[model samples]
Target: MRPLEVWLYGAGLVLSFVAIVSLTRSIVVTIAKRKIVEERKAVQQEVQKKNEELVKQSALVESEYFVEREAREKLGLGREGESVVLLSPSATEPGIAAPVPEAVQETKSNFRLWWELFF
Candidate 1:
């Protein structure tokens, strides 16, 4: 073959190899970008689904019947025309205060009187 023809062929081969490498790199990058986009879309969908679920749960809790039931049970409240009877707990429970003896009251009064007299 002629020298110029050999050089021209070699140049064309080099150009083709460079083009293939560039195309391959571009293809890989494009595929990676597509995958990332798909993942982002999936994550967004999941978040939206969770948000919808939360909205539904909040709506259930905010319903009037749920509020009324909770109030009736927890606060001893009654709806209109509904009778509510409250029963007192037994004295043995922790919240009840024991009655003080009359003697103790008299002693305390005397002590207060003595303290005032001294001061």
Candidate 2:
């Protein structure tokens, strides 16, 4: 073969090899990016599910708290006026004073203050 023809064929082979290498690299990068995207989607789905579960649990806790508060306020079921007789451990021991109930006037005063502030 002539020298010019040989040189042209060698140049064509080098260009083809370079193109193959570049295409292979591009394909590998695309596949890696796809995998990363899928993994991120899975993690996001799990987080969304966990958030929904936590919201449900919070709502249940709030309902229970409301029920207990309603029972306490509306039923007046707490030991309101029952008297307790204390027995002394020993006759020589000093006797403790009876417990005194605090006045409910503070709650009324606070309620009036809040109403005045808001109105």
Best by lDDT: 1
Please write out the lDDT profile of model 2 over residues 1-119, one tens digit for every residue: 99999999999999999999999999999999999999999999999999999999888768967666665667644445754444545644668565566876455687798999999
- Candidate 2: regions farther than 4 A off: 64-119
Give the winner by TM-score: 1
Give the alpha-carbon lDDT of every model.
0.91, 0.81
TM-score of each candidate?
A: 0.60, 0.52
lDDT by residue (7-80, candidate 1, tens digit) is: 99999999999999999999999999999999999999999999999999999999999999899889999989
Model 1 clash pairs are none
